[model samples]
Target chain A: MPRADARANRAALLASAAQRFAIDGADVALEKIARDAGVSIATLYRHFPHREALVAATYAREIEDLAEVPDDGSGSVALARWLLRFVEFARTKRALGDLLHAPGADHPPARGVLLDALDRILTRGRADGTLRDDRDPADVLALLAGLWTLPDDDTWPVRADRLAGFVLDGLTTTR
Target chain B: MPRADARANRAALLASAAQRFAIDGADVALEKIARDAGVSIATLYRHFPHREALVAATYAREIEDLAEVPDDGSGSVALARWLLRFVEFARTKRALGDLLHAPGADHPPARGVLLDALDRILTRGRADGTLRDDRDPADVLALLAGLWTLPDDDTWPVRADRLAGFVLDGLTTTR
Candidate 1:
């Protein structure tokens, strides 16, 4: 098989596996993922030697690109940008939420990408007098952790907007 | 048994049940709760009628008097008062967290009590121009939902304080 075709097949399998993992959780069958990806089982095995490798790699790919999500400036604008990203990921992340939070599990890749992004923006906001000095980025992250409980349906967007707006105001609105 | 003695037994059972509920969750066994109360199993059944009845009544009695927790004048002071009440209840309430959030569960008796208290103070703050108009009491309550996830240990008090303070600042801070 051509190298380019092999690479395309690997990408297809990851995409398919990601959806299955998100929906069916971490234990979905490899054969099912291969069928969904429209790739042979042999190709899935070639790309991922073990099930954990497959799950972790697919999950990492989902969040890896977020490391580059630009901060649209600072203060509320930057905070707002990062929050939307967080909310979006959280919406889909709930399907695999157990895995993400599993105790003693290996720390997932791309873990700090979003939190670091938030730290940068919050640091800028603090310097500019737009953000309060006492708030911690970790606390803000914990506050956002509640977002995981929100329902995944039409009303989710509205609820997410309310939560994100509240957090944003809490951090950026100074007395 | 005399009426006064029965009342005393009931009060003692509730105190034991409340402490166990906070530490062990809403599902702690009635027999265990009875032992802690130093009361007989027959007496617990007589007073509560059933396990659910005991759980509900005990939990209700915990937050029941919150109706009278004084709302100091207005603004941050009043907001702070209500938040402390909220954090304290949330600490124990986590025991019944599943029931509180269960889909289609009748809105728990305690659901709107704290929200209404928050609304009262926030309304006062807005009217007096000491609080931001853009904030909502329900939104603050949602942020406080994160309080349930904090670990059960010494740090809980400190973490709750931080979360409560963040929500207060979010509401009270003027830009």
Candidate 2:
């Protein structure tokens, strides 16, 4: 493992990249991302040789963060809460879809990471019987995929909140 | 008023356009649509001066079809029934969003039409107390927006079906 300062630099660069990707497109300049993260351009490339590598790593960390959303005692409730955070993930990752799903690529680099997190949460819910067994993690992910289609306009935040609530209500408890 | 044969030609052209637009894109050739509809190119142009006009009109007709989905007698059940139909509407309309949301356009031409249908269904549900009053037609549409985001893979149909069921369950009578 790298030393603490190196790790911190990596984290900061990734955070900067995610923020810029959300605000602008994924093609926001590497120099700007490095400056925003308080690191030099050389440091960023030292950590991640290619921009795609940085994007993939940042996305992996996001999935890790999603996986780490603490259980709120209620299995279904925990999944519901995690989904509220997932809206940002869904929308932000969409900006990177074209990049991650580059020509000839088999799957999005982020997809498996995201799906695995979903699987863990869903598996816990099923184990506890707090969620509808009939619902599959794959299906849940597919349902959440709708988030990518929303118009990013003034009403998007409100719409996203409503959409998240809809998913939570629909996915948990017996039908 | 258009004569009987002229009216038939108009309906055929619109039907052909909608079919072609769904299978292909909104930019499908006018000649091809006319040929598919068994009308001449002149008839297609006469009916719709511009491709945008045909897209808007076909989209309007789709909304009318949605509005005409008969209530299954139960207010909530009626809305549930209509949402299954709404998927077809949502997916088919995805191809037309660009055409319908041309420069300076405030909203998709079909939005008000579909939302009106949703509003009527929801209002009835509220009156009957079978649906949650807090959920508005706009919110429901936002939730359903996920419908258009699904991948066009073999699994799409299954995912779409699950998503529709999720929406119905989430919006209906309280737990």
Candidate 3:
């Protein structure tokens, strides 16, 4: 396969893996992931070599998504969007569970990445007078920890969104 | 012992159990609890036939504490006070762990009591225009679930307070 085709296939596989992992958990079959990515099982193994490698790569992709702060100039809006992403990240992380701790899974520092992302948004918001300066990013993160405790049922998404919204409202300046 | 003395001893035992359980967890020595209550082992046993009975009674006391909504007339202030108590309750609940689920423990319906307490407060707050009507009491309860997730360390009290404050801010009408 050409280099560009290989890159596309790798990206597709990662995306498929992330989606399946979030929905079906980390034990989801690699072959099903490859099929969803419109690739063969051989292609999946050629790229990832093993399940741990694929999970780690997908996790890295998630952290990268969180780190990429939009340059929208509105801190509140950026933070709001980021919070929704954070909720999704929390869900995926919960789904990933012990897989991230398994031997040979080389994922990045999630807490550090998340705190930095939150700090950047909070700093921007405070400077722009869009967010309250009373809260620390760590405090916000701690408050958002409620996301992890929410029951993993059908109403999880709605409950997670509401919890995030409450955090956001608390962080925003009283207009 | 007189009826009033017996009642006092029982109340003291429950209070002592709540404190010790919150600090040292459910397995704290029964003798220690008896000592803390300034009572003999026989008195403690007379009031609570077994550890499960003590745990159940302690749990019921917590629910009653939560159910008592102060008529302070300011829903925000009342809710704020209640949130702090709720945090303490969460801590004690965490410490209780499986004790509450022990086969013979006859604790009241915790979730129902909590939701009803919150509903009463939210209704009062909405009536007095002290709280935002957009969020449901259940949503507030869900958001406050962060208290349960805080690490049970030295900083837990501080972190729990901050998280509760954030939730309070979210529920209060913007001034």
Candidate 4:
């Protein structure tokens, strides 16, 4: 297969996987994914062996598409702004964010990148006195996770932002 | 049955329901609850004819037990302490709390008393300038629900308290 064709095939597979996972959750079948992607079962199996692998790959693609920290001294403000974007990402993707974070699941290759990005933001906030220094980045992530736990509705973003503001204030220390 | 025997049966059933819900989530069988309570299946049916009735009863009982909020006049300090206690109730009950908050799930009869208690605390805090006057008490309950969203582990209470403090700070307008 040509390089372009292989890239297109992977892209189609991921797009369909994201759709299926969104509609039917992470238990979607590989064959169904291939059917939805307009690819053969052999093509699907060639691209990914199992459900966990497919979920990890699809989520990694989604994470990579998220906005990264701007290379400026805007500090914690930038971190808070980026977190609002992250909350939107969690809302639109629904349970996929939790699926990615679900423990004992197969390891994703990009987990380190995700955690490091979070660590960088919190570390910057602490240094700049915008966020409290008492908690770890993982706790920050867990607190932000409140978005995914919300009810699925049109008002999700509104409520999620309030929760985000609450978390941001929690991370910011007095004096 | 005598009134004394009937009340004893009710207490036993509620205790067993709480245990089963804490262990097996909201989907526990009524018959199992009856057996656990050492009562006849007919007795369980007589007490709670449906799943929602059983859940409402269990949640009401828990809320009643947790309504011992101190009337101490420390403003948001009092509110914060009460929220910490609420977090403990939610943490120990785990997913059962989620079931209560699920869409279309009816509030237990005692929910009014709990809400009133919380509203009084928030109202007092606002009067003392210790908490923000803008956010609704309903919103506060929804935000503090971040506790139930955390992982069920020994560290959960400590993590929950930290998150609660974050929310409390957000609710505070003073400094």
RMSD after CA superposition, every candidate:
7.2, 7.5, 10.0, 5.2
For model 2 chain B, where is the 10-residue window of minimal lDDT?
Answer: B96-105
lDDT of 1 by residue, B1-175 (tens): 5699899999999999888987777768888999999999999999988665666677786556664556567677777887888788777577645434322224555655655767777888888887888767656766776676565667778988999888877677564
Q: State residue B26's C-alpha deviation in candidate 1, in Å.
A: 5.4
RMSD of 2: 7.5
The best candidate in terms of DockQ: 1
lDDT of 3 by residue, A38-147 (tens): 99999999998888678778888667778889888778988899999888878767644334222122333555566688889999999999998878776776666556
The candidates' DockQ values read 0.21, 0.20, 0.18, 0.20
Q: Which ranking of candidates, highest DockQ first? A: 1, 4, 2, 3
TM-score of candidate 1 against the unseen true structure: 0.65
Docking quality category of candidate 3 according to DockQ thresholds: incorrect
The residue pairs that clash in candidate 3, if any, are none
List runs of model 2 lying over 4 Å from the truth. A1-60, A67-74, A90-107, A149-155, B1-20, B25-54, B69-72, B90-105
Supply every candidate's count of residue pairs whose N, Cα or C atoms clash at under 3 angstroms. 0, 1, 0, 1
Tens-digit lDDT string for candidate 4 (A1-175): 6689878988999999888888875556778989999999999888888665677788775677662677676446766787777886776676455454443224355555566777887788777887667877656665665565466677777777877777766676644
After superposition, the stretches of candidate 1 with alpha carbons farther than 4 Å from their true spots are A1-58, A69-72, A96-114, A124-130, A151-153, A173-175, B1-20, B25-56, B69-72, B99-106, B173-175
Best by TM-score: 4
Q: What is the C-alpha local distance difference test score of candidate 2? A: 0.73
- Higher-scoring candidate on TM-score, 3 or 4: 4
Which pairs of residues clash in candidate 1, taking residues 3 or more apart in a chain or in different chains?
Answer: none
Order of candidate numbers by TM-score, starting with the best: 4, 2, 1, 3
Q: All candidates' TM-scores?
A: 0.65, 0.66, 0.63, 0.73
